[model samples]
Target chain A: MTRRRLQILMPWAVTLGLFALWEAFCKISGIEVFILPAPSDAWAAGVEFWPQLLEHSLQTLFTTTAGFVLAVGFGVLLGLAIGSSTLVYKGLYPVLVGFNSIPKVALVPVLVIWFGIGTVPAIITAFVISFFPIAVNVATGLATIEPELTDVLRSLGASRREILAKIGLPRAMPYLFASLKIAITLSFVGSVISETVASNSGIGYLMLAASSNYNVPLVFAGLLVVAFLGVLMYALMALVEGRMTGWAFRGTDLMS
Target chain B: MSDPEFHPADFMKPADFMGPADFIKVDGVDMTFSRGEEEVHALRGLDLSIPKGRFVAVVGPSGCGKSTLMRLLTGLAKPSAGTVTLEGAALRGPAKGVGMAFQNASLLPWRSTLSNVMLPFEIVAPHKRRLRANRAEYEARARALLKTVGLEAFADNQPWELSGGMQQRANVARAIVHEPRLMMLDEPFGALDAFTREELWSVMQALWMERGFTAVLITHDLREAVYLADEVLVMSARPGRIVHRQEIDLPRPRTLEMTYEPPFQAHVHSLRDHIQTVREAH
Candidate 1:
């Protein structure tokens, strides 16, 4: 009970301590807020521009989530295709690895060429960056099935389709959820990168515009919102993972 | 129906030598498994006859292709040479109307005990077609099978929640849930404690007495073979073939106490001696 409570509380304590130290150091040094806005300055900016912050935050959130949902849908299907057969696994795995290696930011200008310099490019960038992890994790899960399970299912006269449907997909679920948590945060990075490059309205665009106008407090406020939303989405995914795939969570000691 | 390229029946010279009435037969079979650059011959000249509704046990040393034999019976693997037939028909692919259980008690951890037991109904023939139409009936059938294996109370429990013995019991229930014509058990009780093993022995015996499926059990324990089987066959070391066959004429409803008697001990010792000889020879 104590451990569970400590797990939830400890990170907040650390965050508060770090912010306090940072705030104190800035006050003691008499650093200008333009150079490095204090936590108080960022907080004041956030409250002062609450409506504008929310509007832009919602834009960033929608684009990121749309791309993430696309990644999940496509990633699982691609993973299954690669994982189900040795032939497909060998043929396509290298291609996927090569694709994942290319920096997604480079794809932003290309996406801009295809779609205009706006939400579409941001959504595409989010998808390109986030989908790789989901695909790889799910593929790894299915490809490494227990031989005994296959033997039993086959000896029962289950077809390949049946085996994959009944066993392979369910076995990959924990991996899928784990990837979702990672991919969700990565999607935010993807969206912000594209937005910074070229987008009309999002926190990333707001930050870029504010920084250009020397609004340091507003820039810091945007950063806070992005981090806060990223962490919140990640926590949501972890909760869903606990509820949906708890059975797959074997003792961690066994994994080593 | 099996392979047209090589008819299994023709593999045996003098085909009628194996009585026509035999329910299952493996004739002059040879199974070879090849790795990257090396070939390992796992079975040779493996001939066997299982009469209808008989309980048979195969005992052999480790690395003696005992598992390979079980795999062949299930039609999971075809012989490199010769034939394996069930009820006078060639087993080409995975044999239909068959059930199998391994030593590991391979219940999918995510599923409840009853769901695991009902797994075959989701994949196998008429059951799969009938499942959506008769979900309640099939579930009742699964619960009944679990009851037979003394797992009725744990029907809704996850597999990991159960002890090893309890899981094995569920495994047994899963294997028999479809009411198959043949039951192939490979070291089903090999992992259990002595007391739990003996307890399951009675459970198996009761199940066999009631169901009367043709059971071909592959086990290393001679005592297990002699205690549960109507006839026990001792297998030679790798390139495994039946070396000796002992028919247990002991009366039915045999108790665990009978396993300690002179007659039962005699069968166990002889079977042990045969396996010991095969092991040493190899």
Candidate 2:
């Protein structure tokens, strides 16, 4: 195979080999099924609890998607507001940094109290955790425009709105998409954590119930679902990002 | 030696001064920039007046405020002590009739090249107001402009799909598609390779000649200035004052062949000497 194709396929082959070894070690050592189920056992558990697992998976997906979309919307708007004006950026930067530094997980109890146990608290938790990176990335993107480009636009008598639309937003897309990929994965984690702490729905709740009952295979199934969801969301985001900011990725091949 | 055809406004004026038929005037201008208690004098007592259809080039070293002058002329920056006037009116802010291009072709990557070129039409008034109703007409004009810059084939392509020279050409098309009377080019060819830069020089010259619009080109390359400008203004080092203004007595419709001639060499040598003196003085 060509080096490029080998590089691409090598990681998957390694991962598959590792999984096979893990299954063999578990079976040979005769580990308790409740402690560390084999991959086959986990798959069987998934098939048996398919209906409940599907429901919980859908709940996690919904909350994660809702939280991610809201975070992106608010984050981009806030970022633009902060990025465009020097005075506002300075004024809000310290407060934003302070808020971002606080452990967002600690706010779970407060969020549950405020939003109640269902999807609301979980979504809010995800939003709280994932919004900061998006805002920071977008603000950096918008603020870091080439001064010469702005000068050219200004001399063209372009209006402030035109500058924002043509220069600011387009330039920020790559950074925005990058932050989005990070934020989407975090959103899933946030949703699961919040669901574990507060909700009776979602993959997090399934894992918690399975662990209490000593159903290790079922717990593994729940984790597998979460992993699948995270990968799927991340892949979706990557696809969108590639479509939108493909131009940003060009011209980097020579450097690479 | 006054002829009847030569009006009083046409005679006895500084060769660089805008005659009665001129469109824009930069009167004795001074610009000083302050950053954290240190002041940098960028332009000092600068004056230049551009006739309606003349192509003027300003050549200077780095940080000599050639760009500052372009900004002042376009009203992007007001001179600290003097004024820029357009058609006898004081320019208080960015003149809507002015269009600009730069060394970096700042085309919006998300938009197609044709759409990028049509962007100004959607922002500037009259055109902006008419664009919605006459979208086809404006798109046609943008396409024609792109074609003139040899980028008609890439009209639908994103900015990244284009080469550096092609992107810069698209940038030029974007600047001029609005059909502005005054075009300000600040080192637009500085980022390109030697051959690409020379190629763009001709493209720009042809565009200016066809449009009959006044142009102010700010370049560090002496050959570029001599080849394209009707009058070349050389500014001194920081606290950049217009130290010398040389009218290119060379016949117009100047070709690349002229750049090799004795007169052309002399002009380039003389300008280089003056710039060296300015650099050494500072």
RMSD for all candidates, in order, please: 3.5, 6.4
What are the per-residue Cα lDDT tens digits for candidate 1 across A1-256?
6876777798899999999998998899999999998999999999998998999999999999999999999999988888787788899888989999999999999999999898999999999899989988889889888877787788777778878988999999999999999999999999999999999889999999989999999999999999999999998998898888878875542111
- Model 2 error, position B101 (Å): 1.5
Superposed model 1: Cα runs more than 4 Å off: A1-4, A250-256, B1-18
Error of 1 at B102 (Å): 1.1
How close to the true structure is residue B216 of candidate 2, measured as C-alpha lDDT? 89
Considering every candidate listed, which one attains the maximal TM-score? 1
| Chain B TM-score by candidate, in order shown | 0.92, 0.90
Fraction of real interface contacts that model 1 preserves: 0.63
Worst 10 residues of 1 chain A by lDDT: A247-256
- Per-prediction TM-score, chain A only? 0.95, 0.94
Tens-digit lDDT track of model 1 for B5-57:
33445434444555766878999999998988998889999999899899999
